[model samples]
Target: MSNVIIIGSGAGGGAAAWRLTSKGLKVQILEAGPSFDPLTDYKQDNSDWETPFPVKEGSQGGYIVAPLQPLTEETQDIRSWSFMNGKYVPGAFRTSFGYHHVRGFGGSSLHFTGEAHRLNPKSMSLQSDYGVGADWPFKYEDLEYYWRIAEKISGVCGPSTEQRSPKNDRVLGTPHPISYASQALAAGARKLGLTVTENSLAVNSTPQDDRADCNYCGGCLRGCQRGDKGSIDVTYLRRAMQTGNLTVTSSTEVLKIITNANRITGVLAAVDGVLKVIEADLVILSAGSIFSPQILLNSESVHSPEGLCNDSDQVGKNLMETLLATSTALHPDKLGSHRGLPVDWISWDFNDPISIPNVIGGCRFSPSMAESDVVGPIAYATRIVDGWGKDHKRNMQEAFGRILSISGIGESLPNSKTFVDLASETNSHGLPLPRINSYIDEMATDRLRFMMTTCRNILAAAGCAAPIEEFSSIDAFSSTHIFGTCRMGNVTEECVVNSYGQSFRWPNLYIADASVFPSSGGGESPGLTVQALAIRSADHILRNKGVQ
Candidate 1:
């Protein structure tokens, strides 16, 4: 038996493995996705991007490729609950949400674009800031030192002078030089009075922790072959294994939690279709926001008939997907090369106080990295909603590489009404899967509206053509930075976990994923926070010699 068994190897799990293993505790990481070695297993084929098997119905959109597989399957149509006309109603629409996540080792961070931002200060006090969401157990100041630990562990890089100018801020290293395209966008943003700064990335611009520097090839999305992106596989996971106290089981699916007397004794899992049981003194659930809560809901033990740690009935609530909108423009003047990370430059002025308070929600602006095929003098960028065909190619040639984009990231409030619960449906294993019922709330909607208006003005001033903006009212979706399900609070009556990520119902059970978030921050990417919180959780466990 291991001293600790961690479910999921994404942001939180990876961090906890390193923290606990370094403290000489036995740690076993059970990952449903296969182990991927960037050096040998790098594949560009559809299999590398495809979703795993055991496809379930009501998945609406064909399941998105889990991080493990990299292929697209036949798409599907589905419906979701919508908050319209001041009421919750059912609507018909479809999306490829699952496509954004990955299953294999390292979790979704393996494919993330590496935008690292801290949570908005106001986000910590949601009750005071907006009066709509709940307050966090801790504050931004509470996690400052841990944030630094996370940044160093992840090898993050950004502008030193600018990023560290704030008193509450602490950065790890300097940023990579800007590409020609990023420089141009920064100038244009300055011209429009928007604050454009270096993008805070969880990638190494220079060698750190025995890793190499970024080569400026801009292959972040497809994958970073150079091991410079600082994904978990290259960072914490590497060090955790070095401690010789970590055991990683890849391609092993966690079926459910086995609990007795409101405490977890072990977990039942499937490895290559073979069911097995693993017992541990402590269990930390870091299986991303969607799957973590889903596992709890599926595991209905005698002590927790509603599912483990779900006595509050807030297992999967307050879901938040980053509010994203892209605006494109053709400059007709080629700015520079586009062969680098997609998000080299970013703007933070979307949090401007002038109109942010009254907007339906809030928005954070960032510089859009240039795309390779869309960067020449004769080019303009356009998003083709329809399938790409000959006509699309023709349009592409007309505006091949001249388009520049500006984007906004907004926060979603914690709404008990928007949640995921066990559905009447079950998977092939006969486990009750989760049914997500949610949509963009008013705060998110208001933020998107403001972003559209601001993007248009920024483009006009940047000497580009009018902007093309996409807005979603009821069916909006984004792939990056999904969080919140098993939220943390000071009391068990309201939250599933405590501030240290210990389960309210089980002393030996913990969670260290995005699900522990009380509310998603407005501007900061959850990656840094997730890592920091994981470290903090491990520190708490070690100090107390495990949760009481």
Candidate 2:
């Protein structure tokens, strides 16, 4: 059995672990953060959900190699976001790098909203079809088979009747009832000649995989306490461990990838502050877009001084920080926005560049007030209701369940200005943090404006008052769905990894994360695709090993 060492425990790493372990490979997962017990460590009931947010990311057991931000919760603070300055424009793009980066055995999956998505065909072929973005090395059809496998493993829920391109033919479970705000948002979208469908969520509607059906009490932003949400910890990692072929070591930050003679030898890591080099027959990197390339850059040596697998000088280039926007207004009636899954409904009407008017890439929208507020009185006292004594209490009561917010995610083509590089500052481990320099060009900026306007209109049509620009999600670099850096392609000269996620220079090194994406899909979540690609990579490794 091949001894595989996988970095990260997010969607890609988890899927890879499960698939490789099931194939009888000896897999060891090294996570930078401590593993959490879904039954215990989750803070669904915590008022300050974002306390351990980006500010103190590395102060814990482990930390992501990202652009370090100040130890403050303003990144997710709705109050800090722009109120539109009484105009339609967003307050301001975020400057701090505050992603939904939860470091642990489950990685960001532990705190994600569980929106599983596949890249639309046009999105995959952005460069071929449109003049914007890099096209995928392979077609979407090639990945469809693995999409099915990933959805089944994730217990993703969606209705078969919804005929969205790249969606699963057989979902593991049914979708939950549309959230209260989504009900109105859907109607408003149809009025604007857009199609709305239930989101393909990796959350339970009916019990499956011995997990509870979603109670839909909201507060998902704090992370799912119950096992209903298909976090990597509860799903893939759990199942992988059950196979007895996978060994998971949390709080073990991979410092550098040690190599020799064009082959991966092992990873230099700090296992709970103790440094050691653990050998492996193969290494799979799934440390998301930021850290994956960061680790590669940090592994500089005489053999591969420009960084391993970066002979093409494309390791940390072509970074595409995820683009997102939110517009919110008070609904005429109490929609109970706090209850139910936060974003149960989504629309892919503009998931292709052709569908968008004067837009370069793809985009999608959904109701997100529930996700923004993160449940009951927490967001109100801290973010929304902004007063001192009795007035604050009254405003809190008024805004409690009457919020209607619309969120949009748009695709941005890789540009030269935006990229991942080593920061001048070093961390406690003396390793430099990955400095994320994000830039959205005029076309992407225009696309971004379009998303905000659409969201504002949706709220207005949905019977909400003039929607205020809730947040631009750009403060620092608050990217939740970042992509690219170690992009995959057919040409070894232009890409870091091959079509099968194998590094072009290193035979035994593979990558299975959003970093390999040629282009971000029309605002689709990368969770499903990340898992699918990892599963496919595992199969490729198996095939390379001559295992049928």
Q: Return the top candidate by TM-score.
A: 2
| Candidate 2 segments exceeding 4 Å error | 45-94, 166-168, 473-476
Q: So what's the TM-score on candidate 1? A: 0.85
Candidate 1 stretches with Cα past 4 Å from truth are 39-99, 161-171, 352-355, 369-398, 468-474, 546-548
Residue 189 lDDT (model 2) = 83
RMSD of each: 7.0, 4.2
lDDT of 1 by residue, 1-548 (tens): 89999998888999999999999999999988776656445543334332222122211211122112111221111112211112111223424344256666687777677776666655677765656666779877788778788888898898654432335356667887777766766777789787777788988887888888888765566556678888887889999999999999986778898877746889999876689988878899988877888888888867888888888888887776666655566666755444567788777665522237675234567656432223322223224222368876666655554567666676676565566666667766777666665565555555666665576567767777764433332343544566788889897887899999998769889999988888776656788789889999999989889542
Put down candidate 2 lDDT per residue, 1-548, tens digits, no spaces.
33999999899999999998998889999988876665455555566444332322332332233433232233333222434243222244335545557777778887788888777877787777876778799997899899889889888898765545655456557777897667977888888888888888999998889998899867565678778888888899989999999988887889899999779999999988899989989999999898898899999899899888889899889888778778777787877777788888998887877666877787899988765663557655665556579887887778888877888888878988778888877767899778777765667666776787788888878888875446663343567788999999998888999999998889999999999999988788889999999999999999998776
Per-residue error at 156 for model 2, in Å?
A: 0.5
Worst-scoring 10-residue span by lDDT in model 2:
71-80
Distance from true position, residue 204, model 2, in Å? 0.8
Q: Which 10-residue span in candidate 1 carries the lowest summed lDDT?
A: 75-84
